[model samples]
Target: MKLSYYLLCFFLVFTSCKKTKTDLTKITAKTIAIDSTITSAAAIDSMVAPYKEKLAAEMQEILSYTAKDLVKNDGDMQSSLGNLMADMTFDMANPIFKEITNKSIDFALFNYGGIRATIPKGNITKASAFKLMPFENELVVVELTGKKINELIHYFIKNKKAHPLSKSISLIINDNKYDLKIHGDTFDETKNYTVLTSDYLQSGGDKMVFFKDPVKLTKLDYKVRDAIIHYLKKVDTIQTTIDNRVILK
Candidate 1:
């Protein structure tokens, strides 16, 4: 009787294990066209209407005016939009950075791809600023030695993209040679310079690894977007141009 009972229990366990196993089946998908005529549900629209109203109000708030369009371009040098962004980032953050560390930043550097949208000529709104810089990248200062600064220049020459640089520096790329000026002075190989940039680039965003291993790192606990917004609010007009700051031959 005991042997018969044990045999029945073993059979029950085996059946349970088999029941848990699933068989793989080949399934095919049928392509379906989207319904272009579909409308939003009334209930869903009603629920979202208030939030949409608030968003519209905030986005429409005028911050400043632009006399001309500022756009990001793939030129050999920097674009108007790039210059504006880099210069504003430095201008707004310089005081805060100086207050914190008692050292003013030399210049600001940013990627051209960072400007997501162009500013139309006329009123500049909060929405436009947000469109330009959608990321919440914070402001950071990296203190680099003269050697690393040279690397920064070389990287700029190799990558001929219109990476935004503040007017505090000047760069002229003539064929294989480059002339770099920091703070209106010629590039000094013995001096250490403090550079202001987004935290994203400080950690090697856009493959800017020259910013790594800095002599010092300072976080102003401020967002670059906020700095832009602040500058726009204070300035009545936004003016930036592509001049000798970045030259390519």
Candidate 2:
């Protein structure tokens, strides 16, 4: 009787251990499968598509009404449209981003290609901003010296059609040459300056490699399209006036 009891206990313990191991193995396998599914390129793109579409629609609707009505004079539509784009870039960088990174960003540079179309006269909707910035690019901050900033200006001048800028910075370009100054002070080559711009620029798109050499870089989770949408929503009334911030000669 005693031997039988001992044998029974051993059998039960062995079975329980084996069952636990099997359960763990099953769970681990399931987890791996889930990870693999998420990492698939097609799956990721499909998931992102809906949001992109929604944003594009909203931006398009907004542009249809806003710039057309606001722009009065001839050729004013293009100029006003550019100003709005610049304002969107600046506003997004300032208050909206201050919470994420405590450091105050001195300037913002927005690429012109990102602006899709001129806003038409009337109501500006979320869809309009999306059309302007259709890409899924996110906001990225870079730190660089004044020398690099000058180089960026030169890059812009060289690639006039592709390079568009919205800056809190002040720069003078004469005869395809540039003199860059940021804020109220001249750029100090030895000192570092923090710049807020899109990830597209940081990634060497449109030949903007100046951001690549930053001592520190930070990417915000917020999308650039979303930022423009938020700004447009805040201003129920749209007005397009030339700030003369960008001069193309």
Candidate 3:
């Protein structure tokens, strides 16, 4: 009789503890106007003031100088700024890649849209680098087959936009056919070329699908903005030109 009483109590407790499902009944939304009506907290502002001042000083720190303005729209196939960007990226990221893999990056490429701002004919500061590459894109190396490299060339030609390419590559488009060279060597389909680019592009950003699914992919954990800053510090003056890196005939 005691055991039966205990079982009944246990059943009652279990039924009482059972959870019931809740259903969504109504939804509401409101638009808050953020005009001058909202006042910032004095404590919050005080806490952020020091950090803001420090960042401002660091951003304005001069790193290098440029004689002429470096703009991305200077050329149809290649721009002075684009060339500099590619070259500096290669120069900065190549050593890291080589140290890690004991292999050199064949070339560097970046989209035209990636050049967010141009360097004016004056001092180049840390702020300049940040402005040029505002995104937190890291440097990455992707070893692609020669076929994919060919497709990349075709894409550049089709777009006719100033896509930054390192000096290691020379592409001359003739009608539908093109002549390509890497590191002063004729194009070789049998060999794989390792390209240095931003992680964004490696993931096929800007419709550069050719960069996706490479033979090998390695992230150097280096930001493009940092690379630009480092390069600026190393060089006293920025020297770049629109060479025969890409040509259409």
Instruction: Give the lowest summed-lDDT range of ten residues in model 3.
Output: 168-177
lDDT of 2 by residue, 51-93 (tens): 9998666545643245354321223112465556655766776
Per-residue accuracy of model 1 over 11-126 as CA lDDT, tens digit each: 99998878565787898989977696778899999999999999999999999998887887734578888988999989999999889888889998888778899999999999
Candidate that scores best on TM-score: 3
Please report the candidate that would top lDDT against the real structure: 3
Cα TM-score of candidate 2: 0.65
lDDT tens digits, residue span 164-236, model 3: 9999998888976899999999999988999999999989899999999999999999999999999999999
* TM-score to native of every candidate shown: 0.84, 0.65, 0.86
TM-score preference between candidates 1 and 2, better one: 1
Each model's RMSD to truth, in Å? 3.8, 10.9, 5.3
